[model samples]
Target: MSFKNYISKLVFCNGISNSFKTFTALIINSKRYSSRFKKNTLDLNNNETFVYHLKSGKNKFKFYLRTFKGDIDIFYEVFWRKTYDRHLSFLKKEPVIIVDLGAHIGMTSVYLALKYPHSKIYAIEASSENFELLKVNTEAFKNITCIHAAAYFEDGMINFGNNELSYNQMISENGDPVKALSIETLMRTHDLSHIDLIKIDIEGGETELLSRNNSWLKLVDHTIIEIHTPYTPSDLRDDIQPYGFEIKSEKDSVLFAAKK
Candidate 1:
């Protein structure tokens, strides 16, 4: 924590407070829009129609999304930008393979595919419900391959503790007892080679995954991971260096690393 980072946190805290106030106002004023406005919004449950279409550069894309609910904003343009999207958009080429570990609802997968159509995406999600929606949302993209499995250190079965039913899929590296899988098995099964961008948000399992699978470091070029456990940033820094990767940047709890 430098002086600049301290000041940035202060600003971000203030901004978050203000954004919550605004979101509260929107919810309170939802009655003003009436049922007509709600009806006009796409029925995302039905996959027949395009919810909304936007052209990113020249390519046209469709996305099935609902507005914010219960004051969390729950939307990418709001929450994810501050942490993950900063360096994610640098990709724009074909034949590039992206590994999306812990891909929740396929939102990041859709973004990656739309941003880099020529690239193939290997999206891994363990949550049953979220993975289903992820599959539905990404059905249009030909390049995205969805995997409904958790990535871990050893090759075998492990408990997937999914209490929230939304996010938070942590591998039980310390015997916490959650869903588990073998990363080595997946690698051997898929015959995966080069990974251009890898995004991991599997709770505290990142440490165990990285520490256990030392061979995987050679497969990936860039990795963006959300670290949300007892391990300090310095611990992660020390662990990753041995695998030939160095931290490129970090915001909040998320770390962006590039291969050395």
Candidate 2:
């Protein structure tokens, strides 16, 4: 879909709108408010990458994005897509520890960092191109630690899908070899005793992440992960239910689990 058409279909998929409310949602909640630079402006139409400056509420948000590619889609999905918004009310003020499995050009990391200013966010990205942009986008935040490694079942060199597409990057035996960090290695390397929130979107790597006989799940309070094919929500629910998490809800493949 074209940039303009994608917005119309995505934001107004319900065909429900109010002129006053819909326009406001476009700024950060719904619409793609764009144009030249201003104090607090929005634009998701540019094809090139630039240091974008945006102000929402009292904070100024910055990100390096290529709007023509899938960057803006991910941006809108993370920053304004309502599917992820329901989880934010609980995290807005918490000084949580977050583990982002697929940082993807740092969209989730940057958005979460901005949302949780006191949070210590560990962003793991496997793509070299994405990691380069991740560093540029997240360099301003002191709380975010960017890790250029793929999340996998063990600590070793693993083949990773060339991240030509930002959201679908995954692990593959035929892809380029990259440093792999298991959940255990990540926790130990960062010296994290427990995590308040864990966001897993590492393409299809969740199979290796949760199917293992690992002890990390018990140490996390919350989890929001997208389950790719060959794995169902029931598969994850079965794996995590034993670890003390109750399945709160799900939207598509994204499941929300929290300790009860």
Candidate 3:
């Protein structure tokens, strides 16, 4: 086999060398940077995007994505470069209440803070490891309040099943071991009446969370959820019609919805 094919077989099958993955990632990032450099040099228009620096490790530096239309987080460059107009269309003028459920590492919070400067964002993350990074990442944004709790259908603390590094946010429905509170109760406790955008990514708990509280529909306007129903037993949209939400868009495992 070819040299590249040999490397792929070793990395894909045996999976012993993380160095292979790191080298591949570096190559991909190099291409992306090259493309960005070419675009910035060529596009000398009135509405050009400028990059900003972020407070992260050398590998993951945050940036300010500035175009003629508006400014957003640089970490969201992929989202902005691909469907910048589509995302911008969702921007609302009125003061919005954003609920970022399962806000892994505060990407959505940081993006929302830059996207909607006047909005109030409550970012909930369960994993202790991720919460640590989320805190530092979102510290500069004053409009955001980071809550380190796993949201669920009930209130109380619960034990989280430790699994893969990314799946650390998954929790039980009732919320024991992992600190959790229902959306309805969270609203009442915080004295929040209107929710402009509620983004939920609680593994496969979307069905249970919605089924338990039909009244939550009245409080939420828009929702972006990551559904994790890969195999049987955990169909993401099995009984979601009662919640009064229409799926607007979906890519990979994430679904965007608007209350109808």
RMSD of each: 9.3, 7.8, 13.2
How well is each residue in 119-177 modelled by candidate 2, as lDDT tens digits? 99999999777788999888878999999999887888988875344566678767888
TM-score of 2: 0.79
Find the 10 residues in a row with the least total lDDT in model 3. 65-74
Q: What C-alpha lDDT do the candidate models reach, one value each? A: 0.63, 0.75, 0.60
- Which stretches of candidate 1 lie above 4 Å from their native place? 1-74, 77-82, 89-95, 171-179
Question: Using TM-score as the measure, what is the rank order of every candidate, best first?
Answer: 2, 1, 3
Specify the highest-TM-score model's number.
Answer: 2
Regions of candidate 3 where Cα sits further than 4 Å from its true position: 1-95, 172-176, 230-240
- Higher-TM-score candidate of 1 and 2: 2
How close to the true structure is residue 12 of candidate 1, measured as C-alpha lDDT? Answer: 45
Worst 10 residues of 2 by lDDT: 30-39
